[model samples]
Target: MANIEFFDRTMLEAMSLLAESRRYLTDKAEAESQKMDLEQGLANSMETMRLVARLTQVLAWLLTHRAVHAGEMSIAEATVPDRRLGGRDLCAKDSSDAAKTLPDELQSLLSRSHSLYLRIARLDDQATARAEINTKVSGGPRPQ
Candidate 1:
């Protein structure tokens, strides 16, 4: 059975990667992207934006789960859409041509972030359902 556990190594690793990826994407990757020719610049900037957006979504999901695990927010509060994963549709799109040309490290980071997000998303959904069940069992108000 799945539950939101904040201190586990998995959470640590995910948070670390999110932090590292953010720095790399915003600093190194963004810097190199500025030197591209006009067309290439547009493509690279667009791809970079996508990468940033995807990672940002993943970070939000992780933080919300951490808050729940820490008892700072109830499961129902965490389940609110704003606190839940956003940009699901944006993440759903297949990699674009520009994605293939990204620096190898950036490409890998993008893939890892997306895959990690999906895995965590599944865990979050299961945790939400379990929370609802527990609430009901305890005679607490049910999620609407």
Candidate 2:
């Protein structure tokens, strides 16, 4: 009878510890997931910035080339035929039209990138806090 009681108490203690460990692991996994999401968001924002930079460079080059050609043609008394470059017609009535539109679009994208970065930072903090809690619960064993 005494042996049976001791065995039952030991089983109960083991079950409790198992449950605690499971809960800790679950929380740690969730934190890691959040961290991954934040990292992905940051990566996406960086890619967008790169794309915008490339677009701006292309536009500047096109505008500079057009202005230089126009100047040269005017001096030579020759007509510069309107031609399309990179799918956009350079002789469009509104040469500055696209330029005007781009600033607003770029501004909006930058704002969104800033917001995403802030969210990522917050998530990183949350992940760190969760990891610390997990470590404390596990009695100094690092949370994998």
Candidate 3:
């Protein structure tokens, strides 16, 4: 009867240890999952920032061109409207001509903006790949 009791206590202790180990593994897996999610979020945020920077650069170039063109048009003599059209048409023509003759500096800025956009796109793709990898790592079957 004493041997039977001893065996029962040993079985209970073994089960308790197994339960504790399982809980520890579960907690560890949860922590790792949280870490992966955080990393993915950070990568997404970084990609968004890169996109914002590219857009800002493009907008700045456009604004600068508009400002410079407006200044030049302000000093020029306005043309009279033809008999077939209104006075606004003459100003529109002048503005169109001015746009066609953008300064070299403005062209350079546009080129740089295009390059920046391409770089941002590449970085976004890289971030997406990294996030996918992290997701797979956290969710996939454990290694032996």
Candidate lDDT scores, in order, read 0.71, 0.37, 0.36
| Runs in model 2 lying further than 4 Å from the true structure | 1-102
lDDT of 1 by residue, 1-144 (tens): 154333365577677777887788667976777776787777667666676787677777777878877889887878765677777777645564557766777777767767776776677687678778878888977544
**Candidate 2 — what's its lDDT?**
0.37
**Tens-digit lDDT track of model 2 for 14-112:** 344335434543554345334445655454444334434433333333343344344642211111222112212222112222223233333343343
Order of candidate numbers by lDDT, starting with the best: 1, 2, 3
- Relative to the true structure, candidate 3 reaches a TM of 0.29
Name the TM-score of candidate 2: 0.29
Give the poorly placed runs of model 3, Cα more than 4 Å off.
1-53, 57-100, 140-144
Q: Give the count of colliding residue pairs in each prediction.
A: 0, 0, 0
Off by over 4 Å in 1: 1-7, 96-98, 135-140
lDDT of 2 at 55: 37
Candidate number with greatest TM-score: 1
